[model samples]
Target: MIRKRTLRHFIVFVSVSGPICIVLFHQTSTRSFLKDSCMCNCAMDSEGRSWFSQRYKPSANVTLNRKNGLLDFHTYWWWKSLQNESVVANYTQVVEVMFSLFPDKDHYTDSSPSRCRTCAVVGNSGNLVGSRYGALIDSQDFVIRMNEGPTKGFERDVGSKTTHRVIYPESAVDMGVTTHLVLLPFKILDLQWLISIFTTKHIDLTYMYVKPSIIADRNMVMILHPAFIKYVYDSWLQGHGEYPSTGFISVIFALHVCDEVSVFGFGPTKDGVWDHYFEDFKSDPNEGPHDGDFEGKVISQLHQKHRIMLYKGW
Candidate 1:
């Protein structure tokens, strides 16, 4: 009878203690795993000289060969069937334009200077209206502006110096020969439009009457690789929305090219209104095809991770 009682007691004790032990072990293991993982990731990010950097270098040295197979050609170009058709029909022309316009070398090299190259990604958010970030934005090595985010009247808020301007056909603006026109081509026609503008000045219709020709330097024009766009779309955004926004892609572009990046005039206004500092259009800024909320979250994550400094101007 005592033996039976003891057996019952032991069984109950085992049943009760098993889960507790497992829970304790899981908690300890999770903490240890997180600590080690964080250390590894931080170390990798600190070096900034890994295969990730080499693979995604923001320059024209990225070889476009058959083996690589135009991985991102169809990403944002067209619908599934149309994308395949476009790639088959216009791949060579698109590539030819890219090779002809940009240099054949990568921007940064192993022998490049050790000093940090600061960049300012100036968005057109209404928060920058009276922020007086002009001087601070101009101080960076590279000042990247998007669309028609002008600095003429608002030079006190948005810097006048622009090293790079990211634009597509719809939001195209005339830039100086000194500024690099980083073309974010969403479709094959966008590429054709650029070529025609630079050469024949024929094609001229995008949402609005875009300039058929601009006064930009032929050599300074750099087309963003579709693969790079896809990389940003898939990796950083985890395939969140229809496509990545021009501002978001421009930020990622800066991350590859500059050692330190500072973003200005992003997000909504102080009063939480989504409108440009330059103009108040009768459309919703956050109602675009791109997921603005998801992009904002990613931007916040980048700021939190110390990869980039976000000047909210709030």
Candidate 2:
């Protein structure tokens, strides 16, 4: 706990551009303050935590600026996503308007700096079965689950508490009133889709039919910056696979926000079968287009380095 310490401010880099600086309400500053802080698209105040990778630092702040300017156009991921004429034509205008509906900063990090936030990133791997991690997962300060992983029937394995759900349009489901619907926007239409959910239900199609609106609090909605997504792909993954999977993205997201992160149900089982804990086990081929083998190894490496705690249910 931070005792009666003098509150001091520091100049920190919150933008990927590296020029923008903001004064945050942190208690202390060090020579390594700027060096240790996450300088990605969003702002972070990791006073009590330490990270070893330069690919990106640990930051709970996900969104870069109030209005993120543009994704790195050089990457194929950026250029390819911009193909939609209507979506891309008014991308800037759309984002500015949509951001108005949500909180500018991720409220998770708004708590007192002395409090150590512990997080649980529960994956959908079949290994979660028989682990009895429900009680443990629910105890976390924040619990971030990904995709279509359901918790109603399997609360004994996967906890029922969900603070954030990382999902794209195709995998979206109506979450609890308090849970944040963290949208992983693959394209501009995804952004439009989210806006339509709040306003007009006109965007019924985004390569497939999507939920017109969900039973979520519009104030709790959050979107990841494309630049941060690209950073995880290019820097962390070293440009592996077509793009980063939602599972990996969620892990990275938790790392930024939580001082301690615990991951569950991530890799294949002992028999090497890949399936969700909720689904019947089958000798399913590794889920496409993600490089599952590589990602699993990366998760293990992060665990080995003590950056995160990986719980692989036997």
Candidate 3:
């Protein structure tokens, strides 16, 4: 496992009131644009780039603080506060585990000035059942898929090329060694599970029997910053849902990473059914913690604003 001394500085503990708060040190330098007053638009201003872009965009250089680490103490304890001993222990364990697995540096960086970068954010909506969008999706410079959106059995509608996969322990799956495993940690336990699976093979429980270990490029493995996730929840969705879904987070992640972003397999199907293209069972939008309807509206708004291109394949 690759280790870096600077990884320890990624997260800093501060005393707030009486309890300890985990402050994401890197995000302190950046301004917060997700405040309620600035919810209207993400347009660029004369001052410089839009706050949304500046806040979420992937850094060109991988400095120690820029690497994936918990930055916000409030966000870290948003789901569960550190008042509980278990929570603090879990947070410490996760930090240690992450440090052990932290890459020497980022693998993907900004493309050269001469090239135009395009990315496809593919979901598993049943709308892609017969769209035959495989070739178009594969042609992009990057193809990002979320959860267990498969291509082996549904290549005609969904492309087979997967450059990056945004997932958590619950929705984890194995991928080619060349693909990047972008872990979207919802909580401290999620981060612990990710490191445990890869290093110790002790975590085998989730929604299903998760693979104790996965085969993927360690250098390319990326973890989404908790602050970034909070930004999407507060800025992009305006706190509409309990939390941003993995698919929604992936779209926002692509916005920062790719110059041109295209979305597919989101929203309801032709018959107004919520289902995955690779599965026959129907998905209930209300079943999960996410507000699917609100997310759909936000996605549509992004498309209208020209921030993203939504491909609602019939």
Candidate 4:
């Protein structure tokens, strides 16, 4: 009976002293751990916790300066000549308006002080076939994929390094989302797509809805607010070189949202190939309405600026 009583007392003592020992081990002579721990001033946050902090409350102070004079020529010209109608009335205009909003900086450096981990915006052409860049591309910090496409034999060409998928309600597909999903749309219909298509299973959805919008469903998906979008847009508009290429949009999405970014399938092919990926391959190319040469020139300039990388060779 006496030994049982002693054992119970010993158990109680150890439980109370275990925490006290830990507190002493981590505590400094001048500062008391008790006071600091209450305010989250304990030892460094674990790796997992640090990652969460970067995702939720990043230290970098991102601000969007979009005053009147700050607007660029295309932007000033477009907005000043604006009718009372919607600013982004068409797809072309939407692209234009989106390009106008860029981030303050482009490159995100890791250990290299000067060169950042540049993103190669590879446009889906048949050029990337047999390039053996699927695993290499996947090694990048972040990869962005867009539109509807298949990735079996053409994995090298399309790159399997898709860290994020930018989707609109209209183009939402059943392709599996392994990492993050970003919805780029303005109207309620797009939001509906975000809900119906991206179905909130285990995926994390972020809505970069621009102004003149609202969150229809409270529990649908986490939104990034128009202010953040405007911030990115303004930054891109003021950015150097060809302001807002398709790759530029991806970079802007990453600069504002992700820590580092790498692009794939975003440049002109060896020749001219624009048929949908699912469609059979072809030789003749479809240069967009804008002259291919002109667009290529702009893309080259963005590459030089390090804002984007053009995947030219195999």
Candidate 2, RMSD to the unseen true structure? 11.3
The runs of at least 3 residues in candidate 4 whose Cα sits more than 4 Å from the true structure, single-residue gaps closed, are 1-122, 196-247, 257-261, 276-278, 281-298
Rank ordering of all candidates by TM-score, starting from the highest:
2, 3, 1, 4
Angstrom error of the Cα, residue 291, model 4: value is 9.0
Most TM-score-accurate candidate: 2
lDDT of 2 by residue, 140-238 (tens): 889999888999999998989999999888888889789988988778788888888889878777777888887788888888877777777866788
Error of 2 at 314 (Å): 1.8
lDDT of 2: 0.73
Each candidate: RMSD: 14.6, 11.3, 17.3, 14.6
TM-score of each: 0.74, 0.78, 0.74, 0.46
Candidate lDDT values, in order: 0.72, 0.73, 0.70, 0.42
Candidate 2 contains a number of clashing pairs equal to: 4
In model 4, the Cα lDDT at residue 26 comes to 61
Question: Which regions of candidate 3 deviate over 4 angstroms?
Answer: 1-70, 79-93, 104-115, 206-209
Model 1, span 173-223: residue lDDT tens? 999889988888776677777787778898787545877888888777777
Ten-residue region with minimum lDDT total, candidate 1: 35-44
